[model samples]
Target: MTANTSKSTEGAHEPGGFGALRRLHLSYAGEVQGVGFRWASKLTAERVGCTGWVRNEPDGTVTQELQGTPDQIATYFGAFSRVFAAHPIEYVIAEKSDISPIEDERLFTVRF
Candidate 1:
């Protein structure tokens, strides 16, 4: 999919203000399926206070939509990267781009 870098003003008036809040649609390829990647993502999202959903695609990739403050998302990725470094599974961010944050999204989930 093509990347869209446009920013959204949907969350600008929220409690913590805007610009810092971000939502991203991401597709991960490689040894991502059946490798605990979704669980890791769920845990990381929780740890970083993010709200999103992750699922495995039929094409042997993983897709996730993550939402949080910029810092939180960074921290989530940093932690996930560390996990990857310790494991044999390799992954690439096949696609990632800004998306509109969902209002009242309170929890991260793993889709079956």
Candidate 2:
């Protein structure tokens, strides 16, 4: 299945004029485990100046929360697509939704 590329404009309002900052919870499926997906996510997040955590879920999917400006998040996904293309990693974004951004988040990490 192809990855979801739809962008959600929901939850664009933040109390403190941080409307451009978006946080998304995403679940990826299809060959997402044991294929360096988490590592690539961490690297991509850092490269794009996004703060989030990625982890392998028990249900054979990868879950991630990414926080950044919408542009940064889009850049992160673009980079991931490039990397995955080069490495031939296949995945579908099974789920995606906007969530509250963490205050003072500074890094992206791989969660165990």
Candidate 3:
């Protein structure tokens, strides 16, 4: 008897679960630097099984690129929002750009 793997593998190999992958480019302004924002973002992405990178800008902004399914991406934002809301520092979204998803991304990382 041969074990069929096709049914068990459906949507698991796809980027977003339904073959619809999305990329989110976000820029946050305000008290973002030196507040463990990048660390929080990294953890959130990892927890949601998303792939991408995040970095701090010279102008006191945090930029992130996340790629995954709509649900995964939404979860990532929800996590980040909770982190930011917990801090006393003021936070605001400066920019938000959705781009074409990259097919080769495999893991989330913090960019230096």
Candidate 4:
């Protein structure tokens, strides 16, 4: 499915139901810590109607698990890339997970 590639100007809201869910496990390598990555993700996720959590990994890499419709997920990804690029960073490796049928949730949060 084609994902929304636009930057969010509206408040993100779930599209409802569990249809074509995309669960993504994103990993940012190189200088990802102590740069407010999690906060940016949480904010952007809300703008994209995403449900999940973003947090810092113990291994220095930033990690986040996102669950939502494929389109909304796409927008979330776009927002992440925009936010990541907006701030100076080393490198980002956003890896999509093999998980399927993501749970339907209405909020995105920052994991402590």
Q: What is the lDDT of candidate 3?
A: 0.75
- lDDT score, residue 58, model 1? 94
Q: 2, model 4: CA deviation in Å?
A: 22
Question: In model 2, what lDDT does residue 84 have?
Answer: 73
Candidate 3 minimal-lDDT segment of 10 residues? 1-10
- List the candidate numbers ranked by TM-score, top first: 2, 1, 3, 4
Model 3 TM-score relative to the real fold: 0.77
State candidate 2's TM-score.
Answer: 0.87
Best of the candidates, TM-score: 2
lDDT of each: 0.80, 0.84, 0.75, 0.67
lDDT of 3 by residue, 9-59 (tens): 222334446547877677777777898988988899999989999999887
lDDT by residue for model 4 (19-80), tens: 55666666666776787778888888888777888888788877777877767876876776
Cα TM-score of candidate 4: 0.70
Least lDDT summed over 10 consecutive residues: which range in candidate 4? 1-10
lDDT of 2 by residue, 35-70 (tens): 889998999999989998999989999999999986
1 versus 4: better TM-score goes to: 1
State model 1's lDDT. Answer: 0.80
Please, what is the TM-score per model?
0.81, 0.87, 0.77, 0.70
Q: If ranked by lDDT, best first, what sequence of candidates would result? A: 2, 1, 3, 4
